[model samples]
Target: MAGLKIFGSDPENQPKPRQRFADDVVGRFRAGHTIDDRPASLDEWRITTGDPDVAARVYELFGGEEPQEGAAKGEDNIEVFTAADSVAIIIESAKSLRQRMVLWGRSGKPIYVSDGEFILDENGHPTEERDPDADLTFQERKEKKDIGAVPDIDLFFRLADDPDLGIFLFKTGSWGLAYELARDDVQGALEQAEGPVKAVLALEPVSFKAKSGPRKGQTVSYTKSSLTLKGAA
Candidate 1:
């Protein structure tokens, strides 16, 4: 693994970063085309191909670095390329895609379920298995000991330029647009990856017909991040 220095030790013992949402995020763009190089059906606003103003704003925010350019051209750069949906940067270091559960209440507030302590395998790697000491907060709150738990995936990230930003969580799991994260390609990258996976992340707009919902027959549009992983770090 001499050339595979992409991973590091645990991040918990290190410092945390901020989450890029709303104004904090530079911007998300729909894939101009599919991975095969075909034209995409992108709407107007979500398009981040290259508007002069948008480029200017990006340059201003990033100083020397720009979107047209990939990212820091340093040794730490992993040069990753994901054949999955599409994507960007995240702050991490030898961490698991640690999953938790969530239970919704009548008030519609989300209650994050305890993942308990992750049970590591013989190799010292994390497993979905948990300790029997699971927190009972969800049971107490729902007033039901047998409440069902919805699985959740929490991904934390921060921009290189914005180090002061507190670690933000990108929560998702087997749901609509969020489901893309679970794809084999993207999930594989997360599984193989180790440290702060920073790269040029882009969000491509996607439009499709709803399958089994009230709007089953209606057309809906949403955005998906373009995930890429090149060679090893």
Candidate 2:
């Protein structure tokens, strides 16, 4: 908590970096994360918006090359244009998003519900003949599974509507913020996010490796590296 507070203040006091939290939902959306529900002396909005290495990796995963010179020149800091509210977050990477959805669907924690759709005939109208390509199965067809854009969209929606905590929503534009692997705190967060959409984080760990030799069992290491978050979603 103290770390987050310190982090929040560090960014605010500086000569507004090229990337500051502008009062735009796009900015806010760009710098998206769950609202800090925990009590603290001061509330600091967590942001994750920079890191060339992370940007390169995320870009690679999302089907784009790293930005060239001056790519993020003006958009140094995020601009939160809209107030906190329910919003649909669209992750642009089709392959990566699909792979993550499969991961979350298997987790069984943040139950992923499939949305039902109508069976249309060749004329593009609902017909007695069921469309073989419909997403909904017979069982799901009876109930609209509340399906939306992509898996991340549904996951973010669930996070925002979490009963135990509340989170704001944001859509991905251009390229989302990237985090480097820094400390155990961030790693732990990633493990927890195994269930659904994870927060936008950036960590730059000097070194990271499994504690035990690579085996046929789950393994992990520990660290206490400092974490620096740049911005939201």
Candidate 3:
């Protein structure tokens, strides 16, 4: 008898861009096309497709001379926003007190979280579901029968320089430090800020195991040491 099998049990296979390109090249080769005399290498192809820096790095790895400083704005040139940079702190909601720190790039688009599994819509914009408790006031939540002790506030931060680097969550101790640094401003914003606020964030890199989610045992880094409020919107 044929072995039993579960349909769709295996994860969906998605090919990377390079893999697809390689496959295309193989197909051409099988069709009696010669690639040995091609002018462009795989790295050159990558450079033409918006990854010149990666190509440069690969060249250097193969004993090529290092490119001059500031010659290219690849991975090395990404600027990590420090406490010196003013960040736009958008209070996304009053009920959830959902806060987001935004940094605008020179290109006029928000730079953050280019990779990682964030809930996004078909148009490639971040999307969040409407919270069921969004309509409830804080006091109402405190009085609800099913509600337990308020869940610990979890804050996630994305690096401004490289969006594809993924996001980091604040540690519990770091959360305490941030509270101490901007307690009044945070409380005030939650209570009365009408829109986005401004703040200067002081962050220290930290690594810890995730407390929840499928990634519980995995280590993750976060910038969550402290924050200072600049002003309200």
Candidate 4:
């Protein structure tokens, strides 16, 4: 008797592995790839995912656009800022807590910064002494009032014309003693504002020891600071 031949046993008939939409996009982003000197676009995204429909959908989801040919790169296209330079930003939206507010900065970039913590040391200096490794719960932190708290500010910024390249974290004391003083001044201006405001932020690159997570011992650059408010919205 002839050996039985199995139907649908051919390797060529096997279905190809399904591609993930998010993973393809995220991988490119992590590799620091760009389209037209900005973040990658749908066309470029398609090269990796090989799914035109999904790539288009992802592009639309991010509100990204293809860079025009020969289009001049605007000053606002910058990814980095210096202390001497000021960024005029609009506050599109904000989520505020006692100590911090995650803001949608100019161009929709997310800005994570402290309002100023409530906890202070014996010398009356704000400190984050709580060990993240410690087996402490949120309720315990609340009970101890160890929750990070910062001063309230009324300041906001005008929306940027373009989308943000990425997120930024502006710590109160990330720059230095002088930058901290400037940040305080900006906070004071916000406290006095009666309505939505536009502010020019003075940013500087600073490095500090990581206080939490696996990166605890590593040093990283701090890229945000509040310089001054330009005007009201």
Q: Estimate each model's TM-score.
A: 0.38, 0.19, 0.25, 0.28
Sort by lDDT, top down from the best? 1, 4, 3, 2
lDDT of each candidate versus the true structure = 0.44, 0.29, 0.35, 0.36
Q: On lDDT, who's better, 3 or 4?
A: 4
- Listed per model in order, the count of residue pairs whose N, CA or C atoms clash below 3 Å is 24, 31, 0, 13
Who wins the lDDT comparison? 1
- Top candidate by TM-score: 1
**lDDT of each residue in 32-82, candidate 2, tens digit only:** 233365422111222223344333432343332233332234543422222
For candidate 4, write residues 1-233 as lDDT tens digits.
99555547889976686654321221111112355668531121111222344334334433344322222243212121111234455443332102332233556543333323233344444567433323544334334433322222332222233223222223231223333444465445555665546655554455789998889989975444434546765
Can you write out model 1's per-residue Cα lDDT over 1-233, one digit (the tens) per residue?
36543446776555455433333432333233343555453222122212334444434543432334333243212211223232334545425245544555668765434443554454545578663445545334234424544546655544455544334334443233333443445556755675456654445566899997789989998665443444333
**RMSD in angstroms, all models?**
15.5, 19.0, 22.1, 18.0
Reference-based lDDT, residue 159, model 3 = 26
Residue 201 deviation, candidate 2, in Å? 14
Off by over 4 Å in 2: 1-26, 29-150, 154-168, 171-215, 220-233
The stretch of ten residues in a row with the least summed lDDT in candidate 3 is 24-33
Candidate 3 error regions (>4 Å):
1-152, 156-171, 175-185, 204-224
